[model samples]
Target: MNQEQLEGKWNQVKGQFKQKYGNLTDDDVTYSEGRFDEMLGKVQEKVGKGKEELKEEISNW
Candidate 1:
């Protein structure tokens, strides 16, 4: 999904993120408003995966 769609669904997505990177704190999962790249980057770093992999993981969540 695009940044806007991702941002809008962040609440739901956060849960998925937690499931993958259980060590990420709420602050770690949440980006400053509009920081989609930063959020994704953090998730990427934690999961050691790229966007497509992350999307697939989230989709299955």
Candidate 2:
């Protein structure tokens, strides 16, 4: 998937998490987003892949 599609999927997942766990707040969602970014950064550093390439790999998984 492309960047927009990847982001749309992430938002859907985030929404589902919020709905399933009412206790989760916006801050928690923000933290999750940050963690995902960090993970992508680390993977890119190790694998030498572009951001879009990594995102597409994740989407395929």
Candidate 3:
């Protein structure tokens, strides 16, 4: 998914992430304005998943 699609579905995707990754904090899942890649990187670090994989997962959700 691209930036706009991801951002548009962020809340729903965030809930999916939380369900799959309980260890993630709100900070880890929060969507920062114009810094989606950065926030995603943080979640990647915590969950040991790459950005592309995460994006794909979110899209599937």
Whole-model Cα lDDT of every candidate shown, in order: 0.71, 0.91, 0.78
Tens-digit lDDT string for candidate 1 (1-39): 654665567677787778998987887765543386677
- How would you encode candidate 2's per-residue C-alpha lDDT over 1-61 as one tens digit per residue? 7778888998999899999999999999999899989999999999999888988888888
Question: What is the Cα-based TM-score of model 2?
Answer: 0.92
Per-prediction TM-score: 0.38, 0.92, 0.43
- Model 2 alpha-carbon drift over 4 Å, by segment: none
Tens digit per residue, CA lDDT, model 3, 1-61: 7767776787777778889989887877653433877887899999999888899886887
Q: Which candidate comes out best when scored by TM-score?
A: 2
Models sorted by lDDT, best on top: 2, 3, 1
Q: Best by lDDT, which number?
A: 2
